[model samples]
Target: MAEDFTPPISQMQSTTLTDDSIQFENFSRRVLIKNIVGRPDGGVGLAGKKVTVGGWVKTGREQGKGTFAFLEVNDGSCPANLQVLVDASVSPLGDLVPTGTCVLVEGELKKPPTGTKQNVELRVCKVLEVGPVDPVKYPLPKTKLTLEFLRDVVHLRPRTNTISAVARIRNALAYATHTFFQKNGFLYVQTPIITTSDCEGAGEMFQVTTLCTDAEKVERELKQNPPPTEAEIEAAKLLVKDKGGMVADLKSAKASKEELDASLSELKNAKENLSRLEERSKLKCGIPQKDGKIDYTQDFFARQAFLTVSGQLQVETFACALSSVYTFGPTFRAEHSHTSRHLAEFWMVEPEIAFANLEDDMNCAEAYVKFLCQWLLDNCLDDMEFMVKNFDKTAIDRLKLVSSSPFERISYTEAVKLLQNVTEKKFENNVEWGIDLASEHERYLTEVIFKKPVIVYNYPKKIKAFYMKVNDDEKTVAAMDVLVPKVGELIGGSQREERYDVIVKRIQEMELPLEPYEWYLDLRRYGTVKHSGFGLGFERMVLFATGIDNIRDVIPFPRYPGRADL
Candidate 1:
């Protein structure tokens, strides 16, 4: 049934090219390669029409005994290339045949010979522009290159088939996410990328500071007033002792009340001045320090801040007010993980639903993921076919399975038991009731035990975030993780703890500083209602749909442990 759901290429071609033909008559604009050759008819109906086209040459070769050249050009609007036949009389064949050459030409669309695979070809009439490329210098050649090799050439990787397909798939997924949330009446909220609170409370946030840029100013200040030596500190202490002695002497002399009070005031001022000098003497020639702690008061934000790990806390405020809201933006982590699934920076789609519980959260996450899977199948089949051919063979089947089947739901205890009972494969990590599920465990549950997506809910409170609702049994929290094959956990969500007292207790139990989360708890303080939300890693979704092994390849410019190449 999934294979039967093919995109109507002929209809798409007729509609797009027909409109382009009319536009050419009116405005005379250049046509996109997708509109020209992407249709099921292979652009047969538009023959004889002169049009302007521009793209980089993928491959070119001299033909007809070196009198002309045939060039395969692509503009990245589609995966397909347009065949252009350029005669020697129009332009030099030597410059046009090199791979990665950019060209713009006026050509007449003509039907190719009947036996060829392409239905139509472009016959160049005039050359307009040429941005030549040196075949020896171009990083991308016609030969296949591994994705790892492509990372070194991030800027040019999109020109490759794999990267281009990933880009289109990523774009389709993003569009599907917005469409799915908006259609379901969720308000799109833009949460701050730089936040004061670490949503995960893991203390693994990239500190955002201006200290590096303002280092010179700090150094100059310390140079101007250097820290005092031990001898100077002792002298200041002596001054404070002398001031105390003067105050005591005045009190013992039995002088007039006003005169004694004046002496006491002078002594107090002397002691205060000594204390201030002693404190200034501790200043170092680096980031401002107070009591051996990095003083964030002098930083840009006047307090400690970091790139947001998640937008759940910020979006929850909007959820409490608006009933349903979602924030889709880039988030950062300071993790040094070099695993295929970890990234220093990535985008997250977090949707907060007010008046919902764990069951509602699981249902919403499953439906949203299914919507994305079906969207790619419906609109991006061409790219999907390319992925299926070159990458994983089961990618399409997996998409169809996830899109059509209902996810299996079970408690965390049951999931642990299922893994415990399994004797077919030995898990790398030991199965336990309260320990966090490792990626090996999650994959085994999805790929081996279930053969489908599994939603494991009600995890132990000790292993989950503090905001998750604590069950009445006091052992497990209302949390859930949706694990799929290949990718471990696709979504993590829970019904938020609404009781202010319980949340305070949980915060203390987790040993987290409560000040940073005061605003988040304010949602519970004022007219709190039941709410739930989940965060879906956008790159992980792409990995699942495309069967891409490494998460970095799916994201355009991946930020990882030591790599942020453009």
Candidate 2:
């Protein structure tokens, strides 16, 4: 039989508990004193209202005559803080109740001393210690805690004033983003985490595979794919050279079609010989071959699978159908980079708009960013104040700038010209009209040149994504990157190519297999409209909003190179 539980009459009594109930709830043995702000109603302020509250002890001042412990208690409901004053007679707590010890304080709410900014302080009738706190064990000491040190102790960092404040501000910014998108009539779409296509096409991906990897099975896969033919081998070598510094060899290379075919035939024979050798080695190791090379195809998919670097391409497809859609999820990148800003896994918010050009994308990105800043400032006053006092003094100023002013916009050509003339810092890669802007160059442009967020557009075609629409001059692609002062390359986007033939040509020229991407190509084959979207690094945005410098601190469980701790 299940037991029926009931609360005691004493526990059910309405004692008019206020926010200060946290001061002495469980720590004190007998009566718990709570200091409250005011009446829960819209009646008179703390002066005329009879109320009881509790809070945590922020600081305790014990002069010989009387012990006045300033209790900073919160009901965990609102941002408001309630202070409680404990007389020596009532507070037998002495040194037992340290900072962070939850306590309940009960008293009539009364105004503090003239110099005290607080409106009311409870003259405690009782002080109860709900829990004991050890100051030495807590990371949050009387002195301010640095964000760098807090990175090593992420679990407990949120309990501190600074981190708690950041959480509050981040929550506000997130709320603002959702509200903004909702108001604009955009549908939120959840994109898949594990994807087959390498969206960025950079080929720098963290592979995902669950296929059998026994010695025999691995050899079988090699036999099916076979090594490159002599001609194919030469082509692969050339491709490698082109990516590296082998300009002379590439310039001198020349081969007829027949000669290339002959070389490929010879290479195929050589690959067959190598496969036989591998088979023999596997047999020597007493492993059985699953199937003959001629009988088996490649193991599974057309190509290997990997974590998606971005969700832009997938969302762009939905945008064509839904007209306006956005994907907000985790994106992976295998850069092997160890930086404060880069994360192996980070959340990316990407929104695609059909029939929208690069200009429309810029408008959306700016509006979205500004909307978040304004929302945080309005809803998270306490958190903002905490950050201003402890972390970055310019935090409020930056937020205000984003909310009030228009973002700076400049073409890539003009930006390159400006960089060349500017003497602040010299870049290794010459700032030419055609080259890609490195992260350093972007930071200089936004933090130094513009002194605000800047959108650089129309990058050289050779450097941008394959689907970007070509400019009238045919020299550049209709692409844009929204660069922030501290966070470079905050958003990367472009106006996609709408013409079917042009996209097909571009795909063929790249030499990537087309059979797998038939569906993607069909978008162009059928009705296609001008579309554009940008990927915002969610962690970087959180870093900016909270005035925290490290990307690792923003994520709850950070996954970086060779590090995953649960």
Provide TM-scores for the models.
0.85, 0.71
> What local lDDT score does residue 119 receive in model 2, on the 0 to 100 scale?
69
Give the Å shift of residue 104 in candidate 2. 6.1
Model 1 misses residue 324 by how many Å?
0.7
In angstroms, the error of model 1 at 182 is 0.7
Flag regions of model 2 displaced more than 4 Å: 1-44, 47-69, 74-81, 86-96, 103-108, 122-136, 211-303, 508-511
Off by over 4 Å in 1: 1-28, 217-284
Model 1 agreement with the true structure over 1-566: per-residue lDDT tens digits: 55544334442343444623522311335777877787667788788889889889999999999899999999887788999999999999999999999999999999998899887899999999999999999999899899999989999999887899999999999999999999999999999999999788788999899976677765787788776678877887887788788778877887889988888787788778778778877655666778999878989999999999999999999999999999999999999999998999999999999999989999999999899999999999989998899999999999999999899999999999998999988888899888899999999999988899999999999988899999999999999999988898999999999999999999999889999899988999999999999999999999999998999999999999889886
User: What is the C-alpha local distance difference test score of candidate 1?
Assistant: 0.89
RMSD of each: 9.7, 16.8
